[model samples]
Target: MGNARTFILMAVMTALLMGLGAMAGGSQGAILALMVAGAGNIWAWWNSDKMVLRQQGAVELSRANAPDLFDLTAALAQRAGLPMPRLYLLETDQPNAFATGRDPQNAAVAVTRGLVAAMSRDELAGVIAHELAHIRHRDTLMMTVTATMAGAIAMLGNMMMFTGGRDNRGGALGGILAMILAPLAAGLVQMAISRAREYEADRLAAEITGQPQALASALARIAQMAGRTVNIPAEKNPASAAMFIINPLHALRMDALFSTHPPTEERINRLMAMRA
Candidate 1:
């Protein structure tokens, strides 16, 4: 059901982009929009990991220096029947983690310094399993694609902004609608996809680790700490905020339309309900 919903939402978002394009320039405009989105998605597919990590100043980890972290991730990846993903350490105080890469074979996982110090071994396993689930289901790639479309929509909206007052006909009204409504609609879809995938990742993580309560605990702890501990990199690069296990931005309000994560309390409750 989640996958179907995601597919439908993506189709709707694409149609929204093309509709806006047709409104602005006609059939040729719609074709132009698609080609642009395709190009962005393809470029992102190959470089999202590198770009995100570089933006966050992530340092690569290995068995030589971070044996415990590396080995735990390797064991979890093995249990999940995935290749051993490259590990990274984020130089931040927020207890958070995220997965990246086009697929499991090329994927990487990164954890904040606070996360390594805060979580118990079982909790850490739960977190690693959650990210592995994301890789397993290819959510990383799916999100990159969605984000590309969302960005394209926002870009169209911005272009309409500068051109809105140029005419007194329907062109002006179309520009008004595009400038205001199009970006709003794109943001809504991005939030929906991100929230749904997080739930699915949590559920799969629980199954893989056989430790729902541990994940629940980790979620609760992360939520508690996220507000007090600042993630400098995430604050500087707010777009990457959605990639983290929790909402890493300390200052942003958690609205459904804008927040990438569902309520942490709700997530914990769902995980606790899965206890057996």
Candidate 2:
């Protein structure tokens, strides 16, 4: 069911991009955007693991350097029937973590310093397992593809705005409306698909960990601290926010409209239900 949902959502995102292309540019532009989006998927498929880890400023850690964490991930990967993905650590104080890679064989998992210091062993296992699930299920690939297309749609909207400015294509009021509405619509579509994938990932994580409560606790703690502290880098590059287990940006009411993750309370409730 989850797999089917993911396929459907991906198709929807692709169609949305095509429409945005047609609206902002034209039929030729639509073909161009599709080509761009396809090329991006190819790029992400080959290099996403390195790119995402680099974006987070994560550093490779070995058993000699970070023995416990390394061994923990190794053990969980073994249990999950996955390769031992590279482990990384971030310098941030926020308790957050994420996984990145095109597939299990190429995967890497990174946890913040704060996450290591803050979570109990069981809780940490749940978190790590969740990331492993993402790696195993190819969430990284899905997200990368989605980001590439959504970004193109948003960029097309920008191009339309500027073109309208110079050509007087839609006159003053009409141009203003296109400039404001187009990107907003595209962003909302991206957000909807992102949110759905997150829910499915959460459920998959619970199955991988076999202990939903731990992930639930970890999520609650992460959500509380995420709001109080600032992930300045994430704020500067909000497009990558969807990659994290928790949204890293500062609180904005509008973020709810475009949240990548489902509500924390609801996620926890679903986790708890798994025990029954």
lDDT for each of the candidates?
Answer: 0.83, 0.76
* Each prediction's number of clashing residue pairs: 0, 0
Clashing pairs in 2: none
How much is 265 displaced in model 1, in angstroms?
1.5
lDDT of 2 by residue, 30-149 (tens): 777677767776787788777777777889999999999999999989988999998999888988888887778888888999899999998899889888877777777777666666
- Where does the lowest 10-residue lDDT sum fall in candidate 2? 165-174
TM-score of each: 0.89, 0.88
On residues 1-276, what C-alpha lDDT tens digit does candidate 1 reach at each position?
A: 545654676677778888777766778878887777667767888998898889889999999999999999999999899999999999988899998888889899999899999999999999999999999888877666666677788788778766652342256666778878886787677787788889999999999899999999999998899889988888887667777899888654535447878989889989999995
lDDT of 1 at 67: 98
CA shift at 273, candidate 2, in angstroms?
2.0
Off by over 4 Å in 2: 1-11, 23-25, 165-168, 172-182
List all candidate RMSDs to the true structure: 2.5, 2.5
What's the CA RMSD of model 2 in angstroms?
Answer: 2.5
TM match of model 1 to true structure: 0.89
